[model samples]
Target chain A: MINRPEPILMKGNEALAEGAIRAGCRFFAGYPITPQNEIPEYMARRMPEVGGVFVQAESEVAAINMVYGAAGAGVRAMTSSSSPGISLKQEGISYLAGAELPAVIANVVRGGPGLGGIQPAQSDYYQATRGGGHGDYRTPVLAPASVQEMYDFAGLAFDIADRYRNPVLILADGALGQMMEPVLLDATPREVLNVPKPWATTGMKDRAQNLINSIYLDPDELEQHNLNIQKKYRRIEQQEVRYEIILGDDADFFLVAYGTTARVCKDVALKARAKGMRVGLIRPITLWPFPSQVFDDLLEGKGNRQLKGSPKPFGFLTVEMSFGQMVDDVRLSVNGRAPVYFYGRTGGIVPSPREVLAEVEKIYAGGAGKPEKAGN
Target chain B: MTYEMLFAGFGGQGIMLMGTLLAYAGMIEGKKVSWIPSYGPEMRGGTANCSVVVSDEDVGCPIVTEPSVLVVMNEPSLQKFYNTVARPGNVFVNTSIIDPHHPALARLVGENGERKSQKEKGGGRAVMSENVSATEDESVIAGEGVRVFKIDANRIAQDLGNGRAANMVMLGTIREVTNVVEMASLESALQKAISKRHRDLMEINLKALHTGAEWVRSHDVPLLTPAG
Candidate 1:
């Protein structure tokens, strides 16, 4: 366990690496990529000190495959990359999912479609939450907004991955990756929850030969595997959805955002409140499960009984760093209960707090929650 | 209290280092802080910038679009970011290379109230005075309220026998002006921020910081003739 009780300055990438090592990750393999090169650079020096193995693979595909091998051996392993590099690892991710290997991957995303600029963007939300890999599978994606969350979620991602025996992702952006912040490392040694991997292909010395394979040629067998994976995903969707609602209970409008964009929206929420508008923020910490239940409860006023009969109609403004991606999830969750609006900037352009506050003002003046024009 | 700062200069001017030191010093003082840099292609001798936020509360956006304090080490940086400084903000300019007559620097009228008495007692170098009025094309937008402090940061560092310590000098000046972090905290942060290979430069860096802080504290004393 890392033991710096006082807050220490650390880059998010360095904090993530340290947290993973503290979480008992024994192996890390990653290729260098923009905005995230610090992860591999950090791991190269720190991993050896902790008796963990670190490899700078030839390519992203090779790096992921190394993680696959390490995970197959029942060791906690992880790989990290940026957008284009993450694209190269999709096939390996799919294989890891199909084989039910517990491994963590971090995507410190840059703008994308092709080799987009090495600036922050939320465009990879669909790719991460929807499982960029092939077939009908899901990866639990944890979107961390702060450097502290980047550290804390590294352990959470590994725990979740091990519990489900599936690939888990930490979805971050270049801004979060490159930013430095004060984070409190645990003062006391954390109790690392040692998960027993009974199905691991460790050696069949006395037990029956453990087979780790993803290929199921028979139609019935493949369907059953798919169904079982879906069942696990459903369990995760119910139990593992993490979200945060800030100043939301007594509000008339909500801003839905995650990761880097969420932090900007939070400032906007405070500013809007200061300006006499009741604005709240819904930040989804876990992007995969999408925290739709919170949206439902807030939209229908199910949780806040006092607001049930209130005359004011509440609205949701989904903010993202993408052209529009997570907005779809917000719409799906809102599902016509409340009018959903969106404001976003694409191609690595982060929205200023002023810009978001202006949007909130426009929405507030236009009489929020009405069935209105589609957002830009 | 929250102070959002932007530091911009050429790639090797230690722009990122200035941000890092402030962030680390703030953290040491038990303040929440964040630093984010302009990475990738921009580092190739072009303008490199970093945003740093120090707050009693959690920092919301690490990117500083409306900087409460702006430190520009080059003319290009001052030209590019002069308008982005919030009203009633603080601006620290490295005047060694930049023209002292730049119109955006019209706000460098006098010393801040807190340091004015110190300036009287110390009898140090004089700051720029407002003789010529600013023209419309190059003046700062909504910049009348900003308190501009100009120091020849590179020259000060060079005087200390290391030109690279300009960032440390600037850091000292910022600490003196903003008091965002303690000088002791900055000293300790310097020990941590400097790597082992560069340990020898620590004393010079600290000296540069002290020199800078000294310059700002007594800059209005008119020991040296004011730049025209």
Candidate 2:
């Protein structure tokens, strides 16, 4: 039996890189950018050591395209960047979604509308959750709050992506990327992965030529392809919604957040409880699936029935680092069963625990505004 | 309970290393721990700071804006972090370089004292500085209101043959004062956490740590109290 190694201190970016390697990621391509340079720098040194290929692409666009090429071969491949660079990779991501290829992408997000400060931010919430690139297709997104999550979810991302044949994104921030924590690598042994690629372009053999094409010229064919992709996504939604519920035993109000925002929300929950409030947290590990059913179940008094008859139990509050991007999803999940409120801090600024608690109080007092209906 | 600390200094002062060692010791003690370093632009020549959190329960927000303790190695670091420290929090200063009556602490006192409505009847205690003259003359009066402990970490590190070992020395002092970890466990953690390439330097670091701990114990400074 392989014993788990003792916990070692590691940065989030380094954990992501290690997770990729253990998840059978044999190909990596990336361009260096602030707050995310460590990912590429680490891969440059480590990939070769692990008998893998690491390429320093000229630009973010090129790096993502390289990821596209490697993913088409049905191999575990990845590329990473910050917000501005992620914007450059949007086209390639959309293409990967169109092609229905499996790959991993990491965005160690920084503050941004454009060329913003190099600090941790969740400003890309809308971009990641609503499909930043031009398409109706959605990629699986994983938001990790801690360095250990950075490692755990990175491996989970690869598996989920391959299982669905869809691109998976590790949505982190500068703080998560730069922070170091003791990570335990003992839960599961490194999975030995072999993605069979009969359709790969590793030079046509004696078998029938396999053509990997995203371009379906015929309108009917394109629609059929879209329908097929939708079917896969529907299957994923049915199977792969992951989240963590904290202190929900007697919770009357639920705080919905993800990534670094969730970490802060947890602290606020503690403070709220101390002040005689029944606040709990629902942290979605998977963003694309959105954990809608979990929210529905909780709101309908299915999960945590102890919270059922609380007199002052409010609805759910969606907290993020962006301006109400994830609030729409929270509203969609609740489907008007209970009030859905939003609180946010943008431009890479994180909300303090006091600010989050203040919002919770506002919602509890029936003062928070009703969530604007989404166009879905 | 959780103890959050910020170690601030110039880049070469091993502030980050000091935080890392504390975090390592916490890990050895089986507590949840996190160590976050300042990287990129602010780490070049400007003040560098790192936050370390150790808790029996799960750690919530690892980015500590108001730390329970501040370990400052330079005047700039002290200036940058003096105001953000929690009230009743300890501030460890390297008094060999920084003046006890630095302008930053004066500003902090002006703001905090006025805002908190502290009475001005008693003279405020200044941050303790090592009295070079007192070392020879032994007659100077030191104030007691503000808690401060003075140590010459550089001299100790130089005597240990590696100036960077000053970080470990500080770690030893923190361990002794805070009781976050025992000295033996910290030494073992240092041995395990450091890279194999630095194995040979372990003995020197061990010696420096003991020396620093002995310095703190021998000084009979009442300010070096345990973090309650």
Candidate 3:
């Protein structure tokens, strides 16, 4: 018989921290930020009990550098911050990526472009998926929509980081970071994946010293390193595309969203379906991979019977909490095959399901065959 | 069943705690629940609110835009959210701090679905003349089908000892009126929300809850089951 712990109500930040700890994360360093302070606070209280180290660094930059240092020594290290604080950690993130050190950085996003409000927003989609730092490097981004996903994805992020020897980011919004929900913790203990880091900078006794540096002074060597990094990113893109498709069998149109916005889109889909309009949702779990295959399949009329016989046209409505960021990727995937409409609310405003449904209805009322890009 | 509840009041009024307890109770009963507090920019002592959504199925959105039930523990919250309640819903007002006949509530209709003003109030209802007159059933129709529950929650808590448990009283009143969660589940949730260090305060809180429930029972308001 499998003994599982009962579900307990927990904030998303606390759950994510606990999930990381359970996955054998031992070192944490983070500066305080609104909507995500709970992560560091939880780590401060629980890390010592597990024989882990938690450091409240003086600044976001210092915290991320500390993570880089710890991860260099083969420790599963992590750091978290909000939007502005995350901006301060970009250089360190680039260093981690360039050095091929495994680490996790969580961003409980707030409004962007500057030191924006502390309210929830998805303005960081572009920054997260498209490498916020200055490099020819890409960090795999996991977007968790619910509190459960926030908990489950922490370990997954760490595992992905270690698997690729690259930094992995968990991109969440203020809402997902602050919300509380019940989560069932796995009671049975399991081994953390046995991935030995032979290249860790532990010691040089009886072995060649491991050099963990991103700067290659020779141009040829630098070019070769960049090529290897690009190859790894391509492999990750092929193998790590994650998304959820809901009610799309006969959907006449699809609403593409992620994170908290996707949850709202789910409700909008249900409401539209109840009114006899066939609506669906395509929620991208991996924002970096972007789940382009789902869009490709839908455009080919694979699942929906209506689109097959007569080539009935269908459109994609991309809803976000930012102004037309993810829509660009959706357009790239659609490749102008169908009209892609964009609807967004910015500056810390979370669009309501009613408002999003109105947008979907508007797109439905209009014929879905056009190939124009509708921007909002 | 899905219940979207919004609890709003001053920061120190335990508004967040009230919503958390409801969410916890719903989770204990094997329901999917989400609770989100408003962490926007605000000054100290400013109004605070939290939204809790409890559903038998998956919770689509944690933020409650149109609430099935709105609990206003102060005047500002009522002024802020009275109109946002869904039609055919319930709004619980703390009459100890909020005037039942305040100008902000002038547009709301009476319980019988008539637009009655303060001047149109008839004779011989158990009116709290010191404040606004308490209605016969202690409720007023706020919208076309929305019922407003007016209870002096502070006075009820004071009567039971410890006025700070007014939030608990309001919780019990809402529980009795809506039956959103079982009483046993609520008791367990209370234990979870409060810490073991302050376990001694549980007795008064339980008393406050019962007192609030008794107030609802003695007033004989209709059952306001949560909207789907």
Candidate 4:
């Protein structure tokens, strides 16, 4: 009998490492960065135990290149870094995208423009969703709010990356990276992790040689490759747009948030409802592919049954740790059908629940989330 | 009840660990917890603090603006954070490091505890210790019947032969005061918090906790339950 598992209290970064290991990730390379240090720290010790390779590269750029090399070897590989470090890996990430390398890159983002302090910030939303590096492509971006998601998404990221033959990004912020919560260490067993990769560059014995490079010398060939990547992105957008709509059916106003910000919004939603205000939460799980359709269907009063009380929502208020990066997506999807307001805190400052609630109250008091023009 | 706490002290006093240990212990008890350390220049030298929230329900906003419990291991942390405690809140001051009857140097003004009249420091970040000078006032802030519990955690840990485990001493008082997690879980979490190489110091850590908890139990004035 497979030994029954017991839940253990774990930090988010550690859970990511554990999850990656359970998902059969045999190679990890990254330089240490705060908030994400625990991931590499755990992997350094745990990888040897699992007969996996863990490399502490000289720099973030070197670390991501190591990930590229490892993934090119047809082994499950990953790299992790914080905001500034992630910036260093952008060039490597762009290369991975061009090469169509199936790899997972986790960025436990911190505040930034330039080494902007080591506190958590969701400012990397645009960086993750819209391409961070010089590229005309997209990487599947997963935002995990809790430690459980941190664990669960690690394996899922590798699968998605492999399935699409593209790099995947786990866009976690410092708050989620550092928080501790109860999690099942290994939900996915070793036997279930045997995904096939025919395009991997292994030692060419009897098989044809495989080349892992993003270079297309010909303009026509490069254009064609870009179009093909676009096709894959379209397919991803169609098939995958995961989100959770909590009691938004009856809500006169919807609060859109993700990760740690979503938790604060949930608390505000509860408080606002308790005070007889119609407030609810809608949290997006997948940052890329944007889950834009969920908002569209909700606004149109389509198949989503949980939106019970109101036939349609008044509008959405996007809450984030950054100064309204994801809010643009919310507005793009809502498309003027309903007003959308943005409340955020950038530069490593975390918003309190009460601070978010006060904003919610302001929005609600402005007459059913209509959001009377600014300063009105 | 949601248990929100702020642990504050200098860089190496294990202030952050106190919050982290509570968070871990809460997780062991199947509770939700978020531990957020002050991840700025303040962590470099002068003062370090972290906010920990433990709740049976989901925790929103890991930043505890007005914590339900405030544990101060140093005088600067006490001065910097004293007023942020929620009314009818519990404040644990380490008498070993902070004088009970001390007046803050900076003149008090607005409601938000923003101190004015400060000199430049580290690119104008306004170091908390430098902003507030000392006074000889004998008015005790953590006096009787105010829900402020004073304990000599430093001395308690020193008595147990590990002065670094003063965080554990403060944690013991936290267990007794908050009762957010079980004592057994706290003890086990403390054991795990210590590195394996220092297993020899485990006994003394436990002793320090017990001693601190005993002092709180014996000295703190009874807390009146807030009526719903």
Candidate 5:
């Protein structure tokens, strides 16, 4: 383990960069983009100091490919971009997943369908967890709410990527990337990772030349590869459903959210509790795993008998900084056991706590959320 | 206690710097801080502003819909945010650059102080008359009760040989009025926020802080006595 430095205040972007460096991320390739530009800026200055590599690639596509190259050489590598930039890297990310290469991609996402505004938005939930580019693939997406989480997740993304032999993502947004806060950055150096990858494509001098290509002309071989990836994903879903329950027990209703939206919902829950409303909150840390069991547990209770001071157990309100993406997962988890409702703000517009509370009140009063388009 | 403040001014007025320094000072005080800069085309020459929240507990969303304190360094900034300052909050209005006699301003002293010509009095309390008519915006501001500390922050900074230090003057006033962060920690934050090349201005900036705090102390003037 390395020395833990004194706690320093930093923007979320800078913290992620420092976390990557601390996690022994020796290679970083990324293009310059707003909100998340600080990641590349920090890496450019610090990577060389640690005898690592940092490149401001020509574009997002080139930058992601650079990450693929570095990861192929069995080195800790990373790349970061905002929404549009992440969109551009999806093809490369899909390839990374197919090849079973381990790499970290930090998506400090912004509002978007195409080159959307730079303000924070969690609209990329579907793009991140359900596969954005092509084919059968899933990226383990970790959402960070605070600057501290941004730092910790940067390292954790790399560790999980290597451990699972998959591409991992730090799925934060512009708010989490731009907002500044105090972060404790000391402890648990990257040497503890110590992931052995003899199968990695290093030099062929002492061992068999490892092939690192996604293209499998044989249909049966490709199908087998996909089945293997799916099996690993199932394992991840079973073992890595990280979430936090805020005042969940004995509460009447819950606000389901993630990342910055979760922070806002926490305020709403607290304010509602102050007003004698039994409101609780659920924050999903791993977006890819989706924490369906958490939802299932909350929805299932003694039938017909509601808890005191609360609505039905399954009557949960999903608040997202997007136009209702995660609510689909929430609804799926409930599966008619309990009612699921949603409130969201898209196009870089953040929902205030007051508005979210108002929506939750509506839900508690038997309002049903109009389900949106539900395909991947 | 959580203190949410908005520091606003022209693009070059060091408004963002003031907010950053406050957030950093909050960190020095062992408090949780979130600094959210208003990022858009509006920040160029328009009203550049940033919201800073210093809290003992974990901070929620960083955006300040209604700030508890406001440092308005320009007329546009004042006009833009006066209505959004929460009642019972504090406002430090920069009288140097803004027209105190501006018809729409809800001057703090007009109700209690003697009305004098703008030429005779450097401050603008005459607009307190609007507090009577109470336009919707003005009603939200003065009618709701706010301690308005009208200071010639620009003039004070100029007197200190750096007109740009007006933001610092406003910051000092915030420190005195809200006591959101410790004075010594603010000074340390100032040193860290300023670059080595501008280390020479550290003393003058500290002077600006003292200058603003002194102005607030002497204002024995009604900083807003919350409306009953």
Candidate 6:
């Protein structure tokens, strides 16, 4: 019997560790960095307790390569780091993505325009959502708003990685990494994950030789590989889109945000309603699959019938800490169905509730007059 | 009612422990609770702070901008957090090495709606005591509304066989004054929250908490009535 408590206080990194362990992650390899050190620390202690393998590699680059090795073995593997450290691991990540290996990589981001302060920052929004690793490829990103989501999504990340045969990124910030919240800690049983391993490097004795390689010198062969990966991505786009809706039924304006930024939007949505503004929030849980359909459904009207001259009462406002990363995705999702707007605070500064409320007031008071360009 | 607090001090002063204990106590009482500590470079020696939120309903945002209560163990922490306290809130100050005149001093208002400057009350350069003492005599005379409880957390911790446990003592005092959680529940939570390696130190810390609570009770520390 699994005894699950309602809520238990936990740091975001610690929660991630628990979630990864429960998700049948048997191997973790990573070097330690500030703001995300707890993840590796927790994994080091807990992995052994669960009869798993935990290796603190010499560097982030080596750790990511180790993840590459483990993932080739068709075992659930993971690694974590800050922005600078993540920068170093980009090469390995690109290789993993190319190889079509399932693995989880957590970027508990801190400030960085080249090793900026260790304070929490959303500067990595562009890197995470836009694919930091070198490739004409994309990785599914999950942004968790609270510690509980941190725990829940870590497990989900591993599952999605395996199902899609792609590297999954948990794009969390220092605030989430350092922050602790009550989280129900129930280990998802290992038997629940019936992972198939036709390609695993588990020694080919009674089976065909398994090959896990990203390099394909023949142009046609590489093209075929790319085609297969693109098809998988397309399927992912069709089937996997996750988001949280807050008071959307009566909303005239929709606030779009993710991760810690979404939490602030939730507060503003409440205050705006109290002040008689019909505002709501669409918090994207999965950033890569982008929840484009949700945006389309909201803007184009749910059913086939359009409300005559109602003109889609909802206007999409993208709120992020970066200047305009997620806003581009929101615009693409809306695809001219409705006007898309944006509000952001850069360089490690989080907007206050009052600031967000003021933005809502401005938007309501003839501020969203000019339609924002598609990719701004 | 929801109460959010930020306890800040030097790295070794038990600031994080204080916030954890409050969170544990809130959990024991079935209230939603969160404790987020400072991580990375800022946590080494520069400064350390932790945010603790206890609420009746689900806590939407754990990051606190205007905390109802602020606890400072040093001058830097006092300067850093004083402006973030909500008006009509309480602040606890540790006045051992921190002279009230240190440029990072916090502004406190007494009961009579007048600002009681710490420097003026502490006589510009009051001899820094090894024990915690309230230098806010001017606030008492002026009747400013803000409550400032000063304590020598170091002295309390030493008496408890570990100066680091002063944070727990301060948490006990805050609980007693605020009635945020029951004293027994807080102590039990504290026992569970502390690592097993430090299980032997739990009794002394609990004793320290009780001592601090008794002090608050005996002194009749005025509680901040909840905001309407």
Report per-candidate DockQ. Answer: 0.68, 0.59, 0.81, 0.47, 0.66, 0.50
lDDT of each: 0.85, 0.78, 0.86, 0.79, 0.82, 0.78
CAPRI quality band, candidate 6: medium
Model 4, docking class: acceptable
Regarding lDDT, does 3 or 4 come out ahead? 3
Scanning candidate 6 chain A in windows of ten residues, the lowest lDDT window is A303-312
In candidate 5, what are the lDDT values of residues A38-118, reduced to their tens digit?
A: 999999999989999999899999999999999998999999999999999999999999988999999888888888898
Off by over 4 Å in 2: A1-4, A186-189, A193-195, A303-312, A362-376, B103-146, B156-164, B193-201, B219-228
TM-score of each: 0.91, 0.88, 0.93, 0.88, 0.91, 0.88
Candidate 5 docking category? medium
Clashing pairs in 5: A252-A310, B146-B224, B147-B223, B147-B224, B148-B224
Please list all clashing residue pairs in model 1, or write none if there are none. none
Instruction: Candidate 5: list runs displaced more than 4 Å.
Output: A1-5, A187-191, A301-314, A365-376, B107-143, B221-228
Candidate 5, residues B1-228, lDDT tens digits: the string is 888888888899898899999999999888989998888668867898888989998998888877888888888988888777776777778888877655435444234332334315544432434342222223122444765666778888999999888888888888987889988999999988899999999989999999988876765444355565
TM-score of chain A of 6: 0.93
List, residue by residue over A1-376, the lDDT tens digit for candidate 2: 1336878888999989988887889899999898988888989988998799999999999999999999887678999999999999999999999988888999999988899988888888788877789968888889999999998888889988887778888999988998889888755668655556666677777988777778999999999999999999889888888888888777888888888888889999999999998898999988888888776566565544544543333578888887777778887778777777778887767788888898888777766665453111
lDDT of 3 by residue, B1-228 (tens): 889999999999889999999999999999999999999865267779999998998999899989989999998898888778875677888989999766555443333223344335754553322123334654642334566788888988888888899999999989987889988899999988899998998999999888888877887454433332
Residue A90 error for model 2, in Å? 1.1
Residue lDDT tens for model 6, A146-256: 888898899889988988889999999888888887788774353435668688899979988888889999999999988998898888888777888877776778899
iRMSD for every model:
0.8, 1.3, 0.5, 1.9, 0.9, 1.9
Per prediction, the TM-score for chain B is 0.80, 0.77, 0.85, 0.78, 0.83, 0.80
- Candidate 2, what DockQ? 0.59
Docking class of 3: high
Q: Could you give me the TM-score of model 5 versus the true structure?
A: 0.91
**lDDT score for residue A360 of model 5:** 69
